[model samples]
Target: MNDFERQLQELFNEVKSMIMMGNKNDAIDLLQANYEAVNEQINAGNKGIEEVAILDIIALGYMYIGDLKFVQSLLDMMSGIVDSLKDDEPLLDAILLHMGSMYSTLENYEKSMLVYQRVINVLESRYGKTSILLVTSLLGMAKVLGSIGRAKKAVEIYHRVITILELNRGTESADLVLPLFSLGSLFIKEGKAVDAESVFSRILKIYTKVYGENDGRVGMAMCSLAHAKCANGNAEEAVELYKKALRVIKDSNYMSLDDSIMENMRIDLAELLHIVGRGQEGRELLEECLLITEKYKGKEHPSFVTHLLNLAASYSRSKNFVEAERLLRICLDIMTKTVGPDDQSISFPMLHLGVTLYHLNRDKEAEKLVLEALYIREIAFGKDSLPVGEALDCLVSIQTRLGEDDTKLLELLKRVLRIQEREFGSESEEVMLTLKKVVSYLDKLGRKEEKFPLQKRLSNLRMKYKQKVQY
Candidate 1:
């Protein structure tokens, strides 16, 4: 390696050490100093792969410290001159790969995909199409494609990655697990439960063969398999699998008790338990999740809001509005204190509390809270957005309970229908119920002309829905 590249490597290693030691401020200062040194070199007409290397590492350092603004600026600077750099420059490959990942993290998927393609091109030119080294960039491309809803293309790329891994490392090689797991996850998301089950079962077998039955990886695979089973309508078997996986995970100490993954697993199981008429068990699991988050992140931390909200939802589901109210209030207070009262996130607890209050027959209070939530959602998500539509729908229910003006309710329902049409399309089944509500309201108001068109549309939608169901 060149002197500058070697120095950059040492600098990053030191930065990593500082971060591991919880010296984030020191790491940032070190990165800032290096950034200046590299800037001076580029200003002095030494803009080359070595300079790109320094900038890339600095961007990664900022990303590590959760300073995405600096990462974006650095990426912008690199993008200006990256095309001028040689395709075969050794340092350039890693720099491009890091840039691609950073861009993806920043949600600039277009740029991320292009950068990943560039890295793939470099790797392919250097080491044929089947080279194991090409897997990293290919995986990045596949992830971007998946994020953008090109699942078919993403699936193709993932299969290609698996084929390459198998060609180089044999069919049963552990290296195949990454692509297999990714593809399996994609299948689950696409609602191909049978395909997902097969893929996850393959993963379970591979992990068991490689690391034995009690390994953490096997437990994780079992969890995925359980999810597929649940999706396939085998909830009893799925619950058994989930319980066994949890036991294995705990026994193996795969993650700490308060780990986010473990917390989510508990919450997922809690929700599923509630679905299967196990409300008391689900409530206990939700309580456990709350305690875990509270112990690790403190009760007032923003992270505690989700657990509180989940527990509140559980209580609400079981007709315990009083307990749900208390938990919802706690969630609102924590979120409002953490992110300010007007933040979009506060609307979640506010809407839930509105519904809870409505259920308690406190219609006036519910109307006030839902109005505030609707206002916040309109500002944050736009008047026509689905979130705003949800807030509006909640407000409609509260207003109806209050026996508000029929004309006003009718206007609100029409707005909701318009938003649904924009989001779910003009003839989507989702619009049918709202259309019926609108037509019924119009008939109540003696607007036959208005009700006639909507009534006709609703009939057609019902027909289409029935046909789809029958098919």
Candidate 2:
């Protein structure tokens, strides 16, 4: 080999050795050095394949960092590679898949989606339309899009994934459980509780036959079943499922399985307990979990703030207003520091603090804080959105208690009702929420007429949904 070729081979061998050693920091350093060397070589008109390999190494290292900026750089580097790559090139499909993974990490739903489209295109042209790679890419992309809030695209991709997973699994295979869980999760997010319940039940039957009732997979299935149960207003059933999941997680820890898996499971169990009226128990679990989280994530970390908020909610539910208010204030201050005052996370603590103060009979302070929250929501979601309606209800509730029944209170009520009807249909939970508020508004305003209509509507709804099963 020529002298230039010999040096380039040496550089590649050094990077390969670093990567094989599994020292991620050392590998990254070597990759950076290779990148600088490649840039110099490119500047001197060397269009050799080693430059592409160096670019690949650099982009892959950035992928390991996982923060959004690094993921962005990784995706940008992939786009550069894609533009330069030819169809049917060796490693081209693999590079595209890595690019898709980077976009997925960055939460770039649009780009992740487009790269999957390109993946399918390439797979169809080269490997035929029915290649397994197509299905794999679709499922992977669906997970990313779902995580990033693109539910429609996720549903579409999930449908294709279901078809492929089923085809590959045949009718009676246990592998169908995987996609069933994925689609069930999406169905839960979409409020299709019946559909999610069906999928979860099917998966539970198969998984139980294979792994029994107390396996970790079974624990997750139980947790998912709890979500479905909660959606159906079977809070009692949901609570039982949460307990079962918790027992399984505890068992797994006792058996020396992965603690990280059990940790998140325990958190979910605590969260479910809080959701189901076992607030004291939930608070205890959350407090213990918070100690671990605080050690790892610190007090101001968003996840720590999340656990604190849940504990605060439990305190509020148990009527421990002093502790609730204090915890909430701390969370609000932390959120304000990290996400700023205008961020939506600030509203979690803000609303809870307002609620606690209102319960403590500090009406004037509650009204002022709630009014600020309403103003922020109005700015964010427009005056007629569902969130605006929620703020209006909280505001109207305080205003009524404070006896501030001016024309503005009526205007806010009307706005809330409008949003409730526009967003949630007449018989839905949100409509019921607004109706309950309207009844309260009328009661405080001495409007027997308004109260009668809302009462009648609620009675009719109860009758219409009379067949709805509880637990």
Candidate 3:
């Protein structure tokens, strides 16, 4: 190798070793030093592929440290060089791949998708269809598409990638795993839980065949399957699958599994348990998960706030409103400081705290918090979203308990009904519940004329629900 190449390789090794040793700051410093040295070399007329390679290494290090600004700077520099080296297809392709990944990391999905598509077009035009080089760009494009809420398009691209991999590397090859996983996750996001379950089951079988039952990948697939089952409303079965997945993970070597992954699995299991009326068990598991997350990730980390939210949910499920309120406040404080008060994430804790306050007979405080949450939800998810419906439901309950006038409550109920009907259909249990509430308020206000029609609608819904249950 040339001197510059050798030096870059040595620097890469050093940075990798430091990162593996858990000395991330040391790694960053080493990378930064080498990056400046490469810049000096480039300024001294030593610029070439070696300089680009060094920049790539530095960009990767910055990415590891979540230093997106530095990463973006490096990406821009690389893009300029790649533009000058348009004839060098391999180098240009490599730079575009990194640029796409960096844009994705920064949540610039549009730019990421464009870069990936350019890479794919270049690779396909040069090497023809079904080239292995297209896999990376295709996968990147699929992920960006999914991130930008184009799940169907993402799924199509993912399937295309899977087909190419299966044709080139065989069905059971590990190369198919990632595309399959992405496809399954997209299915889940699209609310196609049955499809997700099928995909995950296939993945579980593949992992089991390749790495045995106790492999961490197998455990992860099991967890994915469990989530699909839970989404499908098979909570009891999901609970069993989660337990099995946890056992597999725990039985594996500690080095093979990430602590954060285990923590997330525990959280999922706890959530399912809570859904199945095992609130105490779920609460204890969440408490354990919270302590571990705080110890490892620190209290200010976003994951720590997520654990706190999950634990608060457990507390609320167990009727410990005081504890739930305290935990929600902590989460709200952390999110407000870290993500700002106006972030959509804060709305969840606000809504939860509002519910807890309502249960505690603090109607005024509950109303204020719920209104704030509703405003945030409306801004973030629009007026017809399920989250807006939920926030409105909480607000209506608080208003009803506060003895608000029927007119205001009626308006709120109608809004809730419209949202629920749009989301879940008129025959849904949610619509039935809202209809009953609307009827009750109408009757109480002595509006018998309006109450009769709502009562008739409620009766029809009850019949539909009964017939559905019977069949």
Candidate 4:
């Protein structure tokens, strides 16, 4: 390293030591002092690699402190100096990499991709294409592509990374797990479940060979495979795998009982169990989750809200509206206190409570809660969004039970039909059901002109769907 770079490294070592010693303010002061000194040199027309190095270190200090707003300004200054330098500058690679990562963190994906590509070019010129040095930049680029919804391109980049790793460190090397796992997750997200199942199956085999069957990593891989199986329509096998995975992970103690990872796994298994007609088992798991979070995170923690909601759903499914209402109120209170009443999250519990009140024959109270939920969802997700559509559906039912105006009910039904058509195509069964509802409403409103076309459309949909089912 150059003299200036060496001095910069030493200064950062001291900064790190101060931070480790809990002298965070003292470290910030030191960084500020060095930053000012560097600024003075730059202002005096001493703009060089040394000045860039100083600024980069100070920016990194602020980044470590999570003061990204200040780091952004420092990066803006560095960008000007770095742009003036050639691609072959000695410190260019490191500076570009840092900038690429920070830009990604700031959600400036376009700039992040630009710098990451530059770093890849510089590294490829220095070391050949398959060099390990290229992996970091390639992964960064892949992440940016994934963030921007370019899934096919991201999958290609991940495959390239896997190829490079296998070339350097054999196909079975543990190093393959990171990219393989990422590719599998992307496949699942894209609903290519068969592909995801194959990828996750290979990951499970790799982990078993490398870490042994009882290793926590293997258990983790198995959990992923189970999810893929579930997505691919093998619920029975998936349930068995989830049960085994829970046992292995707990036995290994790699994740503590109350760790968020373990907690989430239990919740996932619970939801699946509930879906598979094991509601009692699911309720037990939900209760366990509630106790664990309440013990470790305290009763009013936002984490408890999820467990309460799940249990309430379980009770509601069993027709226990009283208990469900009680749990939902606690959940609603916790959510309102944590994120305030206007947050979109509050709408979920409000809708649930509204439905629960409706089941209890309290139409007035149900109407009030559902109307509030509809207002909140409309503000958060826009009027035509699916969440708003859901709120409208609930409001329609409550209003119908309360014997509201027929004209108003017809409007709500028409809006719901429009939303359903937009979301699930005109030919979808969901749209067909809404079309039937709309037709019924039109008949009640004495709109025979509108009713005739919808009745014909619903008839066509039923015939089409019946033929497909029979085939």
Candidate 5:
């Protein structure tokens, strides 16, 4: 090793010794004190492999101390040197990985992906395919893809990385846990709940063996498993799992308690409870979550908007339409400013607000808002989507309450039924519900012939459902 390398080694030894002696504050101070001198030396023509080594050591020190701002500054400085070290491929790769990680930490996922792809290309050229060195870049790419809503692509990449790690390491390797967890989450997003359940079960097993059953990581896995269970229509089991997860989080030491995680889990549990008819309990939990979220995450944060909307839903369930409308209006204002008027994110709040308004006897305003939400949902998800069907139902309800001419309401009901049939098939519960609405509207319009066909279809679907359930 050269002079810079020798110095870095000494610093590393000193920092490690300080940590061993429980003098982490002193170690951080020493690293901070030496950082500027190292940078000045590099500026004064000492920019070699050892200079890069020194920078990496300093960056690691900042990371150890959890000072991400300093870590970002050090990575930015290293980025300027990375291009000049083209001949030093390994050093270039390391610097690029550091930069990518910093970018990811800052939520600049697009830039993170660009840097990670470059690292992947360099590693592939240097070491060929199947190299363990490609693992980090692959993992980063998968994460960026998932963040950007490319769930299928993210799943593919995650599986590829898992296969490589399992082959190069072992089936039970710790490295497989993260990818498994990510894959499970992606599966859930894609509505593959059975697949998600399988992946999360594996993760739960791994966490149980490695970290013990009561670890917070195990709680996370259990929460995910609970989501899958809920999706699979086992609400009681899901409720139990969610409660168990919360218990693990509650039992954790105070310093180890993650407020954001705890709040999110509580919100999820509340939603499940509401779905299972425990509206009072669910509403109380939602109110608690909303308060905590507003206190820490701030009222304007996206997560705060989510909590507000969820609480509004609970209020709506409890027939507290006035409070529901107030909360939903706040959510709409925030969403409009953050995501713009026409974004798909605005649709849910608009629809909920419209429903609340309709309940409060404001049909005209409710109709306008519901129409806007319908337009947005149709543009984002097409006319035949489930969301569009829901929007149509809202419009139908508003028009019916206004006592409008039966023609338009009847046509709207028919359209909703068609959309449901296309999306869920004629035998599904969604189609059955839409068919009933269509029959009611047709009968009110004195179109007995039109009602006859829908009535027959509903009867057949109910019989089919009963037969399946009985068997």
Candidate 6:
């Protein structure tokens, strides 16, 4: 072998040695040592395994180790090879898409977004926007964006994908289910259960008829249904659906399962387990989910935060307050540092922390945290936002426990009802449910003079919803 080939082979051996010796830092250093040398080899017009083969192995190394820094270095090394393939659109598109994949691996979604834009710019401009590669690129970018908290943008892109798919195949075609799932996930994140249910229902029908009810995809769709049902406040039904889905997944083919999909299923099933109050099962599943996520995305990632927050809630419910409190505080610190103290993302863990404290009969501290979360959410999502209603509901429940017979409590309940109605429409189940709580508050106060109108409105509302339910 020549100098370049000799150096690459030597470096590869060194990397494997470092990893085997449990000296990852040394492995990174070794990769750093040969970084420029590898680029030189790729540029020196080598056509053997030392160039493309070495580069591919190095990329896989960074990816499998799940180190953001090493993955970035691997990407930077690939840039030289890409620069030489400027006129080769296929190669360029593949390179750009691969960059998107790496950024996705790191969950650096904004960077992944820019990489996808490059792919779209090169491919669509060169081969026309109607090409199948363009469609796939758009869908892939949408998926990444959705994963990284840009659900609105992802929803828009999913709609465009749906439009393209529909134009090519029409609504009755199996292609509809793909975009339907994307939209369903987008709706789920935003707490739009009704919309999500509709999309998942469509996907379920198509997937069942096309792939059979016993298929893994049918199971996946059932998982989505379970989540939506949970969001709709039907946890018992969600638990049943999850059990059915789990059975199907366990029996069906595992070869088709991707890591991301499997991780999601793990989380969804864990959440359902929690809904059924099987805290032990949920905690075990969440722990396994965390291990897989840590292997794929590393620690201190938002998804890491998500799983921790979720499990902490389970811990609190299982009466393990200390562990729950520790996780919540870490989450609080991370959210404050990353998104700032006032950002809405801080509200979720805080809300749970407050509720957990309340469950432990620590009302005063719970009130403080819950109010802080409510204030932050109101500032971020407006006074009439559903996020505000969520915090308000938490506070109202706490107030009921504290035996606060104050007008402020009633006013807060009224505000929650108004916000839910404003955001989700007056006939929405969430609005009706909030109104039910308000009626309960009035009932406790024995203010029939004030409660009569609410009682009548609720009866009418109940009738309306009951009729809708029956039909």
Stretches > 4 Å off in candidate 1: 2-4, 17-48, 65-89, 106-130, 148-150, 294-298, 302-305, 320-347, 360-392, 398-403, 418-425, 428-430
Give the alpha carbon lDDT tens digit for every residue of 341-451 in model 4: 999999999999999999999999999999999999999999999888888988988999888998998899789888988998899988888788888889888899989
Cα lDDT tens digits for candidate 3, 213-252: 8887787789899999998889999999998888887788
Residue pairs in candidate 4 whose N, alpha carbon or C atoms collide under 3 angstroms = none
Off by over 4 Å in 5: 1-214, 224-241, 250-264, 342-344, 375-386
Model 4 regions lying over 4 Å from their true place: 2-33, 66-73, 320-322, 329-347, 362-365, 368-389, 414-435, 450-471
- lDDT, model 6: 0.79
TM-score of each: 0.82, 0.59, 0.63, 0.83, 0.55, 0.48
Tens digit per residue, CA lDDT, model 5, 173-236: 6678888988987888888999998998888887778888878888888988998989878898
Residue-by-residue lDDT tens digits, candidate 2, 1-471: 256445655655665666667765776677677667776876786643445555655665655533357547645654765766676665566557767776776667678778777877888898776555677777778888788778887877777766766676665457677667888898888888988888887877777778877777777778778878878778788888877876885685543332555556667767777776677788888887678778876887767887788789878888899999998888888888888999765765787788789999999999888888878887887888787787778888788789885556876877888898898888886676667766765777788986897889977776666656442
Instruction: Give Cα distance to truth, residue 303, candidate 5, Å.
Output: 1.6
Q: How many collisions per candidate?
A: 0, 0, 0, 0, 0, 0
- Residue pairs of candidate 1 with colliding backbone atoms: none
Model 5 Cα shift for residue 377 (angstroms): 4.4
The CA lDDT of each predicted structure is 0.90, 0.74, 0.85, 0.90, 0.83, 0.79
- Residue 100, candidate 1: C-alpha displacement in angstroms: 3.8
Stretches > 4 Å off in candidate 2: 1-28, 41-50, 66-85, 107-111, 124-133, 143-159, 162-178, 254-312, 318-471
Residue 33's C-alpha lDDT in candidate 6?
Answer: 56
Candidate 6: clashing pairs of residues: none
TM-score computed on alpha carbons, candidate 2: 0.59
Question: Considering only N, C-alpha and C atoms within 3 Å, which residue pairs clash in candidate 2?
Answer: none
Per-residue lDDT, model 4, residue 11, is 86
TM-score of 4: 0.83
Q: Lowest-scoring 10 consecutive residues by lDDT in candidate 1? A: 299-308
**Cα-based lDDT at residue 142, candidate 5:** 91
